[model samples]
Target: MNENRRWSTRENDRVLDEIAKRQQNLRKTIQLNRKEESDSVCLHDKLMSEI
Candidate 1:
C-alpha cells in the first residue's frame, strides 16, 4: 500500500509539471503574438507617414 501511494504521488507530480510547462508555453505564445501585433501597427503607421 505504501508503494502504491508513492507511485500515485509521483504520477501527480509529473502531471503538475506537465501543466506548468504548458502554461509557460501559453504565456510565451501570447507575448509573441502581442509583439507581432505591435510591430504590424508600427509598420502601418510608417507606411502611412511615407504617403
Candidate 2:
C-alpha cells in the first residue's frame, strides 16, 4: 500500500516534468518561427525596394 502510493507520486512527477519540457519546447519553437518569418519579410521588403 505504501509502495503503491510512492509509485503513484513518482509517476505524477514524471508526467509533470514531461509536460513542462513540452511547453518549453513549444515556446522555443514559436519564437524561432517568428524570427524566421520576420527575416523572410525583411528579405522580401529588400527585394521589393531593389526592384
lDDT of 1 by residue, 1-51 (tens): 999999988987886676567656656666758776566557556754764
Clashes by residue pair, model 1: none
The 10 consecutive residues of candidate 1 with the worst lDDT sum are 39-48
**Model 2 C-alpha lDDT per residue in residues 1-51, reported as the tens digit of each score:** 999999988987886676567656656667758776566557556744763
What's the residue-level lDDT of 31 in candidate 2? 74
Model 1 alpha-carbon miss at residue 35, Å:
16
What C-alpha lDDT values do all the predictions have?
0.68, 0.68
Q: What 10-residue stretch in candidate 2 is worst by lDDT?
A: 39-48
Give the clashing pairs for model 2. none
Off by over 4 Å in 1: 32-51
**Could you tally the backbone clashes for each prediction?**
0, 0
